[model samples]
Structures are given as C-alpha cells and as structure tokens.
Target: MANLKELRGRINSVKSTRKITQAMKMVAAAKLRRAQSQAEAARPYAERMARMLASLGQAVAGNPDAPKLLVGTGSDQVHLLVVVTADRGLAGPFNTNVGRHARNHIRKLEAAGKTVKILTVGRKGATYLKREFASRMAGEITFQGKKRVGFEDANAIAERLTGMLEAGEFDVCTLIYNRFRSVIAQIPSDQQLIPAELPEAAAETASGEAQAWYEYEPDEATILAQLLPKNLAIQIYRAILESAAGEHGARMNAMDNATRNAGDMINKLTLTYNRTRQANITRELIEIISGAEAL
Candidate 1:
C-alpha cells in the first residue's frame, strides 16, 4: 500500500529502466547482423580445412613420428579445456552456459582420473569458473575494449596452445563455446583441437569411385607439418566467430525480453498509481463532507 509519492517514484524508475533496455536491444540487433554474417562465412572455410587435414593425416596418423599436433603427446593423463565466452555480461546465459558446460566436462574428466586445466578466453568465463576451478586455471585472455576480434587474435591463442603442447603441458585439448544458431537459440558445443578428431573416410568419392587419388607436391608429411598449425588457428577462429555471434544474439534476445517485461511492469504500476490517487481523492472528499455536516 504505497502512497502516491512512492508510486510515482517507482513508475519513474521503471520508465528509466525500460528506456535503457530498449536502447540495448536496438544496439544488440545492429551488432548481431555483422557478427552473424561473419560467423556464417567462416564456417565453410573451417569445415573444409578440417576435412582436408583429416584426409591428409590418415597415412601418418598411426606413425610414431607424426606431428604432435595431429597425434598428441601419446597420453590422456593431462587435459586442457579452452573455454570461450563473452567478456561482458547482460547477455542472459551466453557466458554461463559455456562456463557450466566446461565445469561439467572438467568434473567428468576428473572422475576418470584425468588432470584438467582451464584456459578461459573471456573475463566472464574466468570469473564464473574461478569460483570452483581456480586452482585448475592455467591462463585467461580477455578482449574487453576491443572493437573486433580477428584471425590474429585467434592465431595468438593458437600459438600459445602450441607452445604448451610442445612443453608437454597437456595431452588433450578441447574448446568449449556457444554455437550460434538463431536470434534466440544458441547451442553450447565442444570441439577437440589437439590430437585432431578425424572424420570418418567416405566410402565413395563424388566421381563414383571407391577411392579418390591425389598426390601431394612435397609429400604428405611435409604438407601436414605446415598445415596442422594453420588448421588449429582456423578452428579457433571459427569458434571465436561463432561465440561472438551467439553472444550478440543472446544479448539482443535478452534485452528484447527485458524491455517487454519492463513495459508490462510500467503499465501495471501506472494502473496501480492511478487507482491509489483516485482512492486518496475519494477519501479526502469524504473527510471534507463529514466536516461540513459536523459544522
């Protein structure tokens, strides 16, 4: 039973909040367009690169001297999880989803007697995971003020991962992030980076042949040595792009919902305020009439 002054104050506060949410929704929508396009464009290239590497690495996959990036350090004792999330919040569960997914993965790995290490790519993720997995955190990277994230950003991360692999820091590496699907849907996904996950070989070629024959110019080993690292960077870039788009989409959707909720609240409050004011006026009128009759 708030008085008129209190009701007015509450209404004004909600109105201000509604304005902010509306502005944020529009801003997120504008950003989502560019981010979504970039994410969609990177998918094909990344998929093709992965397929090519899978085909090329088939011969050397079982060899003892194969590139470590392709075959790993021959141990699954140590696992590295590279979790990608947004540097900022107010995007609903965009960052939380990835953090939770990574946490569950770490728990699963630990249950199986594996040592888990975390490499967070965003501030929100680091903060969320630091609560429980602080001891397991290997490193964190954030791009808070950066206007855009490009391949160079992904390359730097890839290089760091390569250095760690060479130093025998971790045997298996997996990336966790949100995959952009639509304006309102984002799927949390995990991809293996180190010791590349090879797709199954196709039984028939597009030309209707049982197998496709191709010859490498410098031989398979020579090509793989150079291609494996590039493939790693490309995969990371793709994941980053996907995460960027998903973040924007989630933010836009969240802001839109917030704005709508705010509007509904404002309407309810305004109705209540009017009713209260009317009630007060009626009470004052009745009091005045009672005084007149007494006089």
Candidate 2:
C-alpha cells in the first residue's frame, strides 16, 4: 500500500498526463479533418485516370510497341515493394500494420525463389522494417518534418522508379499503404505500381461493344506513350494522399483512447489518495483521544 504522500504525487502525475493526451487528441482531430478531405477529393480523379488507362490498355494488349510501363519487362523474377508509412509514431498500429504486410510479402516473394527489393517511404517504416528486412532495403525516402505532401513528391518518386526500371533493377513493383475508410478504420492495403492497373471491376468492362466504338486521335500507342507515365504519378500521388489521411485518422483515434485511459487512471489514483489520507488522519485523531482519556 502506498503512503498518502506517494498517492498524492501519483494522482498529480496522472492528471498532467491526461491534460497532455487531451491536447494531442484535439490536434489530431483537426489534422484528420483536412487530411480526410484531401484523400476523398483525390479518389475520384485517381479512379477516373485508372479507368481511362484500363480502356486504353485494352487496345495495345498484344502490340509490340506498347509502353513498357504498361507491359512491364515480361518477367517476374525480380520484384520491388514500395512500402508507404507514417514518418512519425503515436498512431496506434498504422505504421506497424503496413510493415507487417510488407514483411509477409517480402517473405512470400523470397520463398518463391524470386529476388525481392525494398523501397521504404517515411522514417517510421524504415526503422520498423529495417529490423528484419534490412538486407533487402534498396533505399528510403525520409521526410521527417515535411509540412505537406504534394503531387511533386509523388512525381519525383515515380521518376526515380522509372530510372531504376529502365536500368533493369527490378521487373515488377508494388505499393503498400493504408486506405482511409473512417476515423477509426484505416485499412492496410497494397496496389500494383509497376505495371499499373485499373480497378478490378474495370477488367470486366463491355469488351466487344466498348472496343468497336472507340477511336484514338494520333493513335492508341501515341496517347499511351504520354499517358502511362502520368498515370503512374497519379497512382503514387493517390497512395501518398491516402496514407497521409490514414495516419491522421489513426493518430486521432489513438490520442482519443489515450486521453480516456488517462482520465480513468486519474480517477482511480485520486480515489486512492483521498482514502489513504483519510485513513491516516483518522488514525492520528484516535491516538490523540486515547492519550487525553488516559491522562
């Protein structure tokens, strides 16, 4: 049993912690609103671009001159996993979940006798993944204090990937991230990046009817040459936006939970302190009364 003084000190500490957690929760809530809006806004544009790419892709499926970005290197022996995660912690499992998924993926790739390479974006993930997948790490993109994420960032990453692809560093690439579903739910997910894709639903489009009416201006090949790279950048930008939103959501939820738990602790400690102090005072009063009666 702790003495009255110790219990009082503990109560004070818990109250202070509760205040800090409350402040963090507020900040996270504000950030989450803005991030959520940005992510929601990007979804449609990204989906439309993906649909257009899919429609165009059908035209050049077998053509020898299709963009390499669309067709890949015709090999799956080497794979690159571009894992996206928060650059900071305190976001309950957001970074860890992605890292876990990537870890499993890397293991599966290696198991299949395929060479696997890792490219991590964000400081949090690099540290988390480096423990086990350190040998497979090809590079890391760290933006510790970057105020905002923008399309230019995605474009830069895409360009770096294109350079590596052109240099035959990897045959295929995949992106892993968290998709923001709600404040309490950020779904860890992955998307194919190297040989980009439309939504799975797009794959089942009206095949014969759609192809007969479509016409290209310069040519399907000519349009794809300009579009495929842009599409890649778009996809990456979408992933970044999604990840940014998810991180904030996770943080908000985490801080909220922390604040509540701290409040509960404060209540419990305060009760203990009051009871212990009362017990101490009551014992002192009894001792004084007994001495006076004896005298």
Candidate 3:
C-alpha cells in the first residue's frame, strides 16, 4: 500500500494528465469542425467530376486516339499505391488503420506476382510502412510545415506521379486514405486513379448506348487529355481533405477516452487515499484509548 504522500503525488500526476487530455479533446473538437466542413464541401465536387469523366470516357471508349490516362497501358504488372495518412500522431488508430489497409493491399499485389511501389503522403504513414515495406517505398511527401492543405500540394504530388507514369514507372496507380463519413465513422477507401477506373454509370453508358449528339470544342481527345490529369489532381486533393477530417475525428475520440479513463483513475485513487487515512486515524485513536484505560 502506498503511503499518503505517495498516493497524493500519484493523484496530482493523474489530475495533471487529465487536464492535458481535456485540453486536447477540446482542440480536436475545434479542428474537427473545420476539417469536417472542408471534407464535406469537397465530396460533391469530386463526385461530380468523376461522373463527368466517366461519361466522357464512355463516349471515347473505343477511340484509337483517346488519351492515355483514360485507356491505360495494356498491362497491370506494376502497381503504385499512394497512401495518405496524417503527418502527426496521437490520433488513435487513424494512421494505423490506413497503414494496415495499404499493407494488406501491398501484400495481395505481391502474392499475385505483381510489382508494388508505395508513395506515402505523410510522415506517420512513411514511418509505419518502413518497418515492413521499406524496400517497396518509392517516395514520401510530408506536409509537416504546412498550416493548411491546399491545391498546390495536390498539384505538386500529381505532377510527380504523372511524370513518373509518363516515364513508365508504373502501369496502374491506386490511392488509399481514410474517408470521413461522420464524427465517429471514418471509412478507409481505395481508389484507382491512374488508368482511371470508370464508375458504374459510365461503364453502363459505354456498353449500352451509341449517342450521336455529342460535341467537343478542341475535339474529344484534346479535352480528355486535359481532364484526365486534372481529375487525378482533384482526386488527390479530395483524399487529403478526407484524411484531414478523419484524423481530427479520431484524435478527438481518443482524447475523450483518455480524459474519461483519467477521471476514473483519479476517483479510484481518491477512494484508496481516503480509506487509508481513515484506517490510520482509527489506529491512532485506538492506541490513545488503550493508553488512557491502562492509566
């Protein structure tokens, strides 16, 4: 049993920890609001862009002159996995969950005799993956110094990826990140960007309809050439936004749990201290009574 001084010290330590956790929880909550709003705002635009791309892709499905981004290299031998995670930690399993998902994908690809390469977007993801997939990591990008994620960040990453693709570094590219669905629910998602995977709506149109009412300004091939690259950048930007929101939500929940656990521990320690002190006082009172009776 710890003495009063030691118990008191422990209680004080726990109280201090509780204060920190509480503060972190509040901070996470504030950040989550902004991040969530940004994520929500980006979703519709990304979806609409995807739909438009899909429709356009359907129109030019069999065109020999189609952009290479729409009709990819005729092989899936090399794969690039772009994993997006948080640059910082203390967000519970936000980073771990994404890393695990990416790792599984990498393993699956390897088992199929396909070459796998990784492009990590955050420090945490890079560190987590380095333990097992270090050799497979092609590159890493960290936004540690950036106060806010912007289009420039996505554009730079896109330029690097497209440059690598044009250089024949990989045949297919997939992006993995956590998608923010709600404050408590973040879903890890994988999307194929390179050799773009046409959505179901576009796929349907490609197989069933022959439309003669389509018009293009510079020509379908030229428009697709521009749109395909823009789509990649936009998708990356959306993924970053989603990851930002999910990270805050995960951190907020983790901090709340820590705060509650700290409170419980404090209560338990206080009870123990009170009981011990009461027992000590009873022992002293009994000794005094015995001495008086004997006298």
1-295, model 1: which lDDT tens digit per residue? 8998998999999999999999999999999999989988888888788667757877778899999999999899999999999998999989999988998999999999999999999899999999999999999999889999999999999999999999999999999999887889999999999899877666325536554466998888889988998899999998899899999899999999999999999999999999999999999999999999999
lDDT (Cα) of model 3: 0.90
lDDT of 2 by residue, 153-218 (tens): 998999999889999999999999887787889888888887765455335454433434468999
Cα lDDT computed for each candidate against the true fold = 0.91, 0.85, 0.90
The local lDDT score (0 to 100) that residue 116 gets in candidate 3 is: 95
Count of clashing pairs, candidate 1: 0
TM-score of each: 0.96, 0.94, 0.94
Question: Model 3: runs farther than 4 Å from truth?
Answer: 202-212
Q: After superposition, how far is residue 101 of candidate 1 from its true place, in Å?
A: 0.9
Worst 10 residues of 3 by lDDT: 203-212
* Highest TM-score model number: 1
Best by lDDT: 1
Residue-level lDDT of model 3, residues 1-295, one tens digit each, is 7899999999999999999989999999999999888878877878888777767888887877666677777789999999999999998889999999998999899999999999999999999999999888999999999889988899899999889988999999999999888878888889998888888764546767654456889887788888888889999999999899999999999999999999999999999999999999999999999999999
